[model samples]
Target chain A: MSELLLQKKHSSYYYVKSKLSTGLPLFAAIFLVLLIALLLLHFIWHGAPGITWAFLTEAPRNNNTEGGIFPAIYGTVFLVFIMSLLGVPIGTATAIYLSEYARQQSFFSRSVRFGVNTLAGVPSIVFGLFGVGFFVQFIGKGIDTAAQTTIWSKPSLIWAAATLSVLTLPVVIVAVEEALRNVPQDLREASLALGATKWQTIWRVVLPNSLTGILTGTILAIGRGAGEVAPVIFVGAVYSLPQLPDSLADQFMHMGYHIYVLATQSPNAADALPLQYASTLVLLILAFSLNLTAAYIRLRIRRSHK
Target chain B: MSSNSTLYKKSKFRPFEAIIEWIIRLTASFSIIIIFLIFIFIFKEAGGLIFGTAKELKPKKAVSEKVQDKSEEKVKPEIYNPETGEIVKIVEVKKLVKAKETESQSIWANLFSDTWQPVGKKPKYGIQPLLIGTFKVTLVSLLFATPLSILAAIYCAFFAKAWIRDIIKPTVEVLAGFPSVVLGFFCLVTVVQGVYSTTQFLQPLCTNIADIISWILPFSDRWIHSALTISDFHYSAVVGGIGLGLAVIPIIFTISEDALSAVPNSYREASLALGATESETAFKVMLPAALPGVVAAILLGIGRAFGETMIALMATGNAALFSWNIFHPVRTLAATIGSETGEVQWGSLHYNILFFLGILLFLVSFIINALTELFVKKYLSKKFQGA
Candidate 1:
């Protein structure tokens, strides 16, 4: 009878232990779910109703208390366009150099890698300062002195785009390098054996295959550049710029900066609440869609390779 | 199989390969050049403030005869005129700084103090308050966020079913991609309201605790009152901390989850086979193995919190004061630079000061990142070696 009681006690203890372990992890999973649910619910409940056609196509009226954010949208699109134009090619080239040309353990390659890593870790505010000091002051002043004009001696879209490109370069390089390295070594060897030169093989075989991945990187960069406000605030973003930028030298409005200005600097935060939420929604959708597309492309590539 | 054949093949594409390779090398070197330029330009502006230009040397002749000859003083007076002027007056004017500094507090001296008055007759560029403010907010954020992120990471890495894991991972990562400006706005509007009321809701409990403590100590009531205010809570360090905590959770979660998942499955199997519970295996076996990665993740999260700009700027009320109170508003280094750099004069002392703040941020983040990278590299190599 004592032995039977001991067996029953041990079974109960094991049952309780198993139940406790499962319950703990379940609680953690629930907590994560609740957080994500709260974020989505908050944004959609507050923001989705404000996203109307009038909100999208029209410019702000009455000190941004009314109308849509057309100029802010246009400015963000233009900035991303210019940023990609500058960031993608150079980023792709650098990745190719790292993966294909430079020896893995070479000093130059290590330094380049270190530079990319350091640049990646530098704060966005520092990038803003660098933009103002280097692009707006030194290089812009040099250009002004050379041309005997004041055209490029201040914050402008070009300077902001350039700063953002530098900020996102590491992202692009990592993505592109992964893509380049994913191309099978046997394919490159086969191309070389078929009398194709190294550059010819790279240009014809490797780059063509990795173009989708490179595009994915550019898309990711655009998504990041679109959302970043700190790097462009002092460099080029304007609070009440009513029109689309006519040239790269013109200061532009941005969705992120506009939200910040409206939320913090507005006279009537209550009245501007709808606009702020709507602008945030637009920015969220933009960044989300871009990220999703890149993720999808990466997934497709991975699947195809398998 | 002949060396000559290989040599001939190499020679065929030597010129093309050389030019293409040079272009690639140039593109790669451009990143290094840009990084160096960032260092150079920031320091150049910051250095200008530390060392100003030379003093003006005016040749002022000391009238030996005490004659009031202002006009003759302008000209070099002759040695034998009625009185000889032999002395020089060197008027050493102070360098043009951004703010008018009083004679008592030097810039270096002011930085060690708690006051951060940057625009006035006696402008004080005290970094102590900002540092304290940063530390307070970061501490609050990490305290609130680290456990949540770590537990969630463990759940995702070990316990979540496959479909649930797929949904949870991307959804959380979506939070990571959300713009900080939006997060700042949300904090300004929603989170601040939530935090204020939550603090207010805890008033009775706080008073109870304070009452309990007051029985032991005479000054507990005053300390509690100062620590927990009944009302008047608006934009504050607590609000900023919550906002920053939200911003950092995704980073910490993603990194820590990766670290947890990178632990070898054999460890889990062995622990399970030895009759250990799953939680025991996870908490005892896996967590210890992934401790380096976890440390690296937390350090990266702290680095991110230190450099975060928009949330702190919008939510922290931009008040620079000397208080250890978490309920009061405080400014940060990143926010100060973000808000002030736009209006500051290009070559003024204030502009250079902002650049100096940038340098401080750069250096701090650099050190944190270097340490994090060191630990992360070790973790990755250890994982790869199957040990």
Candidate 2:
């Protein structure tokens, strides 16, 4: 009993020493937290009622004080919607083909997986170069008149959306593949026993089981695609415009771009404060809503599956 | 008759299914097409700049013969001033040709060029100053970030109390959520300004120089003694690099900690059983075991440093001049692209020249990342039993 108590006391001593050693990470974390708090304080103090409903609805003009980010809101939403619409279908289909229809060790599938991972790590700026080269210069050439404008005519929203789809393609493939890999094999066997073909079994049993995961992954990809400034700047000439684009070809606005401009390129240089914060708040809200909706959809699918 | 019955009896349409499969296959193949096409696009735009204006004026020692010969005759030396023994006396002829080669070599030579004064109407797009500035800043950042990040991660994974670990991990991750632009703004308004104000107290710390040594000190007492301030050229790369380092440390620590945590439990237990101290196990056994992931994290940090634009763009003194001093501000390739891209007419010499810079950045970063993923992953980790 005495020996055990002595050992316990010894452990207590080491625990305190361990805590002392932990000081570095703890201090670094706390320092970061303190800086973050200071930044938020600065933001809130300078921007309260300025983050108004009016600010959200108004079009920016006269140094941005007289207008809001109506166009940007629409553009950001449309960008996310269109990118997700295109990216989800192709990525999910590819993931399905890779996971279900092919052997994992096959040369084709292995090479495909390798390409996808490498693509994911390629930098955003590099993607911008690619988009400008392929989408803007080459692909955009065929779609529009060469002398459409004095300069090269800007590629429309359709081109931007398509290019962004390519940029996020690897991410979607990785996500959906992970989701498919998690689905149980027993469900596939059960569906196959019911006289369904491999395609039908995969669609009905395996896909539905993983649909929630697929939705979540798609939402994450869209959220990421929307905020990206590099590729969009290269492929999409979205910035300040008085009117909202009626068609995909017309120049539009994006909340992320709006924040970037207000902080960097605001035409109305003096009043960038309220505009930057308000746009940031809107972006976060949009991202959160998209994620939450996907979560909600996932839950609904789970409940129905059960 | 049998095939017709197959089509009519079932709505499944096997041929249609085959067509859809073909479509999907095309889409899969399309990914490759996109990558290949992108490379083609970058090289096409960048080609005119790198090849040079004329064959005779092309780089004396060609990296390749064909590339040298194909250069436009515009840059070839047609006139000379043997009077002063200058190879090319007429600046205008060379100006036009050098403008095209300025796409790549101009800035590279600028890295070694002694003076930063823009010649006459157009400044030759020399990059030596910016390259010097970038390296100095990056070196400082590594100095600030590497030791702190590695040590903090080691401390957290090996020594932290469980309760503290949970709190520390999440908080550090939340730093990733902060937009990089915001970090730049913060550094500009606060860190840069703070350093400027403190310049008064630091002025006395300058090293004393005798008459001959004065020439070697790079800057005189007047510049060092002046109040720290911000303008286009006069600024601080030290602050910018440190600020960037702070922004990147979380990335390093997060990955490094994961590497540390993933170290096999048996190694720690064995070390402990052998009467090794906690610090010894962490530094010798666990760290060695975790070296692969640590290497990955370090390489990731380096790649990030090379590519980061917004903070460096806004904070680096924006002087496209080369200086060895750590305190003086400098420009990075990323900053140059950001500042010049908007102004340069798209598809013109200046514009193509900027793209050439992008090509350099892409090539350098791509090589680093590829090496890390390909070579370091196998060799470094295996040496430590971490791969």
Candidate 3:
């Protein structure tokens, strides 16, 4: 009877200890998830009421305290559009070279991979510094000197887009490479067996299958480029612009920059709170939806392959 | 068959395909070129300062112009009162100028000093305070994030059911999607207030604890008195650290979870067979097996927090004060560059210093990444292969 009692007590103690250990981690996980959910809900609750059609379409009238964010939205779209046009082709071609052409351990491919990793790790602010140094001072000034004009020697839409494309290059390349690799070896072998050249096989068989993936990569890159404020701060982003940019050289307002300005530099932060929340909500929706769509497509692709 | 042979003969000399291949190959080298350009351009701006050539311009011109203007004014004064005006006065001014020239210190002297007043009459560019602030914030964030993320990873990897794991994983992914600026804004508006209230509430209890401790350990009274005081709370390193912690948690969690999951299933089975419970098996067997990856995750997290700009900028109050107190407002290197690079004249000393900070950030991250890639990753591969 004594032995049985001791064993029962020991087992109960063990059970409680295990339960407590498990509970601790569970509590941590729940806490993290709840905090994020609360943050999102807070934004939506505060921002949803202020987001109207007028808010989306009209310009601010009283020094950015009473205007819609239409110009910011327009600038963001234009910036992303130019970034995609510049970055997507280069990234896709690089991915193709890495996946299809390079041998397993070539020095050239190894160096390229190293470059991509380092680029990805480089801070966004460093990218901003590099943009100012290379694009604005060196290349832009060089162009002005050649043309005998002052058009390209300052922060502008083209330089910002160019800087952003460089910043987003790693994202595009990684995504496209993953998608290209998902093309089956059998398909390429079959194409080659049919007397197709390597390029012809890749073009016909691999590229078609991975078209959705390439689109996904582009969307992901655009999403990332759109949300970035640091790289654009020195390159092109302005606090306010009276009108939308008329040319590549024109300065423009951006949504991320707009949020930053509203949050930090507003005359009356309390009064600007509603607009700030609304702008954040819009940007959040834009980024999350783009990421979600890309994720959904990636999931579908993986499932189809399986 | 004859047409097929003729086509094959034509395909053998296809210059178009050759050109296309060459184009693709050239495009592959774009990233390499861009990386090189980034390094070159950033260094080129700072090269004058690095090589002691920046001092050759602007300051000399300004000084000589001052002397010329002074001479012109003195000429009229001397003409009016030739006896009163002594030539020794001009010699004295020249001697003072020479003394000022000798007083101009090296970059290392300026960098090692604690003051960071870069826009004053006598601009001091001591980077020590910025370095300390960066270290303190990074430390706070690492302390806040590492354990919480590891525990969460433990839950997701070992304890949670598949459905729960799925939910938690996606939640973390969504959190990762929040941009750094948004996080900074959230910190500025929400977390700052939250910290203030919480510290206000805890102040009495903390003071009591400090009082008791100081009484017990009499020698620590002064230090405890200073450390325990939370009279007011505002934008501070602790707030910024928490904000950065928020950004870093998902990174650490994801990588840690991956590392934990990468442990071979055989180890779990063996641990179970040895009568170890689920938590014991995970804590003792899986965690140890995945130690290298977790360390790598942490190093990467530190790198991320160190270089993060917007959060440090908007939340830390952008004050470059050298203080050990977490409640004191601080500035980081990245934030310094982000906030100041815009207003500074191009190629000015401030501009060059900001680039120098950039180079420091770049080198640190490079070394961290190289360490992870070359050492930890190799060790992990070896360990898993041996398993």
Candidate with maximal TM-score: 3
For every model shown, what is its TM-score relative to the native structure?
Answer: 0.89, 0.76, 0.92
Clashing pairs in 3: A60-A67
TM-score of chain B of each: 0.82, 0.72, 0.87
Q: Give me the runs in candidate 2 sitting further than 4 Å from their true place.
A: A1-22, A33-49, A101-110, A145-152, A193-195, A266-270, A285-306, B1-32, B53-120, B160-164, B198-201, B206-235, B375-387
DockQ of each: 0.50, 0.27, 0.48
Ranked by DockQ, top first: 1, 3, 2
1 against 3, candidate with superior TM-score: 3
Looking at model 1, residue B151 earns an lDDT score of 84
lDDT for each residue of candidate 1 in B23-53, tens digit (9 for 90 to 100): 8899999889988898888888786555531
Q: Flag regions of model 1 displaced more than 4 Å.
A: A1-25, B1-13, B52-105, B219-221, B228-231, B383-386
lDDT of 2 by residue, A190-259 (tens): 7766767556666677888887778777886786677666556646645677677777666667676566
Give the winner by DockQ.
1
Q: What is the C-alpha lDDT of each candidate?
A: 0.83, 0.65, 0.87
| lDDT (tens digit, per residue) of candidate 1 on A1-306 | 879856864897867976766676677667766976788788888999999999999999888899999999999999999999999999999998888877666799878887888788888889999998899999999999999999798999999999999999998998998888777676788888898887888899989999989988999999999999998999999997756899999999999999999999899989989888889999999999999999999988887776
TM-score of 2: 0.76
Tell me, by lDDT, which candidate is best.
3
Candidate 1: CAPRI quality band? medium
User: Which stretch of 10 consecutive residues in model 1 chain B shows the poorest summed lDDT?
Assistant: B53-62
- lDDT for each residue of candidate 2 in B220-323, tens digit (9 for 90 to 100): 53564342222223357877787778667777888889888877788899999987778768878998878878877877777777666766766777776556
What residue pairs are clashing in model 2? Answer: A58-A68, A63-A268, B53-B72, B54-B72, B107-B127, B110-B128, B111-B128, B129-B321, B129-B322
